[model samples]
Target: MSIPYQLILTFISGGIICVIAQLLIDLTRLTPARILVLYVSVGVLIYAVGAFDPMKDIFGAGVTVPLIGFGANIAKGVREAVEKEGLLGALTGGLTASSAGITAALLCGLFASVLFKTKSKRM
Candidate 1:
């Protein structure tokens, strides 16, 4: 596909996914964290069923920039590990695939905590 069309698709798809998440937030009691986990699980299921490739192809970054993409990445890593390391890969593949993103988040949070003053929310 051409770059312009891909960009357009990405914008629309990303916005749609966000809209669905927002609606879930508004309509359901589920926390945002749970919703995010759900998205990742869904992504993993889709990837396992061989459905996520077309999504990645069409939605590109729209599908990939979110937690669902992270799940797909985990699933992919697990598949590779399963090929190379058998059951051990099933245990460690997701963590191995996701460590960079996890570490980046941790480091960023650590930096922010050190640099900024903490304020307790008044509820």
Candidate 2:
């Protein structure tokens, strides 16, 4: 049996993204939070330059499952909202587009917290 080409591409793309993050962690002074913000900002910039869709087409979920994808989704939502709802879209579009994911994250966190016991780390 042969692996599908798309699967290979997806793996490579996602792996590369992860590798970059790992390298940042190993080599840089920047905190993880800053890296996360940087990635999301880069995503917005990519979308602003009209490159996100083509990259998404090529990379599939590899491009859409990361923080960058979240950023792009927000940009996309805002753009569509602005087109349909005028100025108000700017205020609501990102949250509107991201609501489902946000809700899922919240629900999952709630479930996890209820199911597990936590201890404070002694740092």
Candidate 3:
């Protein structure tokens, strides 16, 4: 059986994103937190320039599942909110657009904490 072309593109795109992150970890002094911020910022910039939709169309979930996607989602939310709610949207839009994701993350963390013992890091 032949592999689907979309699947191949998805794998390759996602892999490239992962590889870039790994390289940053291996070769740079930047902390993981900084790298994450950098990625999200890049995503926001891409969305600002109106490149995100095309990239998402090509990369599918490969683009949408990453931190960059999260940033784009926030930007989208803010834009829509600003259009609908005036200046107040800027303050609430990101959280509103990302609420489901934020809720899931929190619930997952709660479950994990309840289910397993976390080890404290020693400084």
Candidate 4:
């Protein structure tokens, strides 16, 4: 497939996920963190059940491009940990695999917080 097509597919998939998340937030009272965890869990479960492989094969990172991809990384990390460190891998793999993304997000948030000014309330 062309790179453009691949990107389009990935964007659509990611957008759909975002829309679903928004709907859940608007319709219910779930916290953003809970919704995020739910998406990751669903992705892992789908991958575990042998369902997400074909999509992954077709889209490559496109299928794994969203928070779903993060979950997949965790699953992969756990599997690797099991292979290398046995029990320790299970705990470390997920965090290790997703660390880069987490770091980037944190760095961005920190930068925004530093650069942006807020109005102070007068007593």
Which is the leading candidate under lDDT?
1
Q: Who is ahead in TM-score, 1 or 2?
A: 1
Which of the two, 1 or 3, has more lDDT?
1
Candidate 4: global Cα-lDDT?
0.82
The alpha-carbon RMSD values of the candidates against the true structure, listed in the order shown, are: 2.1, 2.8, 3.2, 3.8
Give the Cα error of residue 27 in candidate 3, in Å.
1.4
lDDT of each: 0.92, 0.88, 0.90, 0.82
Tell me how far the alpha carbon of residue 58 in candidate 2 is from the true structure, in angstroms, after superposition.
0.9
Task: Give TM-scores for every candidate, taking all chains together and pairing residue i with residue i.
Answer: 0.91, 0.88, 0.88, 0.74
Candidate 1 all-Cα RMSD: 2.1
Of the two candidates 1 and 4, the one with more favorable lDDT, higher being better, is 1
**lDDT tens digits by residue: candidate 3, 1-123:** 134887788889989998899899889877899989999888888898999999898888888898999999999999999999999999999999889998999999999999999789999
User: 11-121, model 2: which lDDT tens digit per residue?
Assistant: 899889878988998898678998889888888889889999998988888888988999999899988999999999998888998889989999999999999988999
Candidate 1 per-residue lDDT over residues 1-123, each given as its tens digit:
899999999999999988999999999877999999999998899899998888998899999898889999999889989999999999989889988999999999999999999899998
* Model 2: lDDT of residue 30: 71
lDDT preference between candidates 2 and 3, better one: 3
Off by over 4 Å in 3: 1-3, 119-123
Candidate achieving higher lDDT, 1 or 2 = 1
